[model samples]
Target chain A: MSGTVGLVLVSHSPDLAAGLRELLRQVAGDAVAVTVAGGDDDGGLGTSYELIRDAIAEAGSGAGVIVLPDLGSSVLTAKALLEDHPNPQVRLVDAPFVEGAVAAAVIAATGADLDTVADAAEEAWHARKL
Target chain B: MPESSELTVVLPAHLHARPAGQIVVTAARFTSTVEIVYGAKVANARGVLALLALGATAGETVTVRATGDDAPAAAEAVATALRTTS
Candidate 1:
């Protein structure tokens, strides 16, 4: 549990992030902590800075934390938070939302390191859904 | 020694997300290096996205190969995981 890398999924739509989190839990099991920060403060379909910051703080353990943002603004929000308060254990990976989270979760379930988890998520960009 | 198995995917959706995750979990159980070979693509069995990207479908054949001290067991275990992926 301590060795498992945690994941924070940031999305504009709350359902999208929550759904992906559920799927990740099912695929990777609950051994790896999978958290989500979705929607804006007003309950609209947009990214929220506070939500992302809180989720990252919640998901970050001593082992490591990998954050996957679903949209342009989501990425911006996450990056802003990271730039404001740098955390060495946290990294934002550019990967396809669903595939990337799935990849990261599965590897994190195996207690892989942060670098390995990030690589797995980034590798998901090449996941062909044909 | 290295071991291998040519398995016909029985899963309804081929190696979709769930089934691929199953393979990843099973392959992670052994110390061997597990690979699934389909056409010219060879993916590490522990990689869900890579396994899904193999584009292998149901009724198609994929070779499961494992190399390490526990290669034979790893191969057999992954083969079984592939076959029972419904």
Candidate 2:
């Protein structure tokens, strides 16, 4: 595992997360680690703790992990999980999901560190045009 | 000193995600601070979302500017990416 920062996207819909993952892969190739925690245990519209937990574990590629949750309770579920198993390297970012992931992935693929990845994601929301 | 280059977007469908990604990849290869300017919008060239949002379509000229040690090469590479998809 390289020292590049990885990303975990938490969305309520499985397909949404998958599509976004595909998009990121197209851009960053295999340079950045991007995993998704979408849908519930039943594969319906919801967030799953197991999915989120496993995703972070899988995506925590030595350097750091940044988790971006979709909306509403998805955020809550991710927050609750993080509160219990907090690692300073694992960051839960509040930014626009698609834009943030794109920015984060691009920067991470450049071999940027944790803070640079987080800053890129956070800055994405402001850089987005209408 | 800052270096700058300009080119027309030849990619079909304008500055979408894929072409934007190509531009980002090129811009990331240098130590320079790179930017893409289209109309009133100036986007950080290393950022995919910002470049896509610049909204430059085919035939529309965009400028690639950079400031750093490798500014000239950085600006040229980004402009080439805009002119032809990789």
In terms of DockQ, which candidate is strongest?
1
For candidate 1 chain A, the 10 contiguous residues with the lowest summed lDDT are A121-130
Off by over 4 Å in 2: B1-13
Residues A5-124 of candidate 2 have per-residue lDDT tens digits of: 999999999999999999999877787889999899999999999999999999987889999999998899999999999899999998899999988888888888898889989988
Q: What is the TM-score of each candidate against the true structure?
A: 0.89, 0.90
lDDT tens digits, residues B7-34, model 2? Answer: 4344445887777877777888898888
Local accuracy of candidate 1 as per-residue lDDT tens digits, B1-86:
55544443444457777778878988888998999998899999988878878888888788888888788888888888888776
